[model samples]
Target: MKKEMYAFVVPCSARPLVFDESRCVGCNRCAEVCQVDILIPNPEKGRPPVVLYPGECYYCGSCVMACRQEGAIRLQHPLMNQAKFVPVRHAADAGEEKPLPAEKRRG
Candidate 1:
């Protein structure tokens, strides 16, 4: 049977966490501590964990705390502020969406 599909873009209440691939050691500790289950181990060992559900991220920093590699994973609020309006790519749209300022973040 032929099938059709549609896609939608979602804006988040708060910024999602960020990962530094260069600093990540693929230990999976961050995935272990994520309360929302957004992170999962990479299929190949010795690779950084993947964001299984970006929308489910709470920016709780549990993953950051669990990381043995300093500066590997961190909250996006501080980084966003310092970066001065970084734009994130959305699959559904050609234009990038700007991240909300830290003061505007709900959670």
Candidate 2:
């Protein structure tokens, strides 16, 4: 069965995301990883990822991690004004809600 997408709330007080189409490599890894279904893949065109619902973002940084590009995705925290280009692994590791990746075994 297909999972239902949610309208997750993204806290923009930290800062907002910067869209750089130039850095995007048309990878939909972010959309795949997003449980909330915030991002959608552009299949018709070059197949780049687009933020379908920014409000649904949990700010978990899963999208940033899924993005292979160095500066393709960024995380904007409430304490910071500009979104920082944090490594996906590091951001996933920082979150206590879930494990870094599905490949990583939890004991």
Candidate 3:
């Protein structure tokens, strides 16, 4: 009989959680607060928890919110999920004639 081994790998782009070791207190709050159970507490004391399944993250920011140390944990949304804003221009701003008011407008 032969023994079998397995390993799990995560792509860099799929990783959604970032831990700042310098700022992290290693309290394991992030692991405890993770809604998806992707984060695992490090067995070593005073070390940041490990991200077990980065691709499974929900980007809910619960881990970041639960961390007592500021800037310890940060949640990154995928590019497709990020919000984009474009400046809006009114008709007058674009040099277009404004439509006649149906009735006199009151302030």
Scored by lDDT, the top model is: 3
Clash count per candidate: 0, 4, 0
Clashing pairs in model 2? Answer: 8-55, 8-56, 14-77, 14-78
lDDT of 3 by residue, 1-107 (tens): 58796445455566698789899878999898888888777768888888878888878888888889999888889878789987865665677665776453333
Candidate 2: deviation at residue 70, Å?
A: 0.6
The model with the greater lDDT, 2 or 3, is 3
The order of the candidates by lDDT, greatest first, is: 3, 1, 2
Tell me the tens digit of each residue's lDDT in model 1 across 6-101: 333344555476678888889999898889877778878877887767677756778888889998876766444555556764533655455654
CA lDDT scores, all candidates in order: 0.72, 0.64, 0.80
lDDT, model 1, position 71: 89
lDDT of 2 at 38: 69
| TM of each candidate vs. truth | 0.56, 0.52, 0.74
lDDT by residue (1-107, candidate 2, tens digit) is: 69985543444333434556778777677779987886677655655566666656667887787778888767665554346685456334666555445564433
TM-score of 1: 0.56
Alpha-carbon runs more than 4 Å astray in model 1: 1-15, 78-107
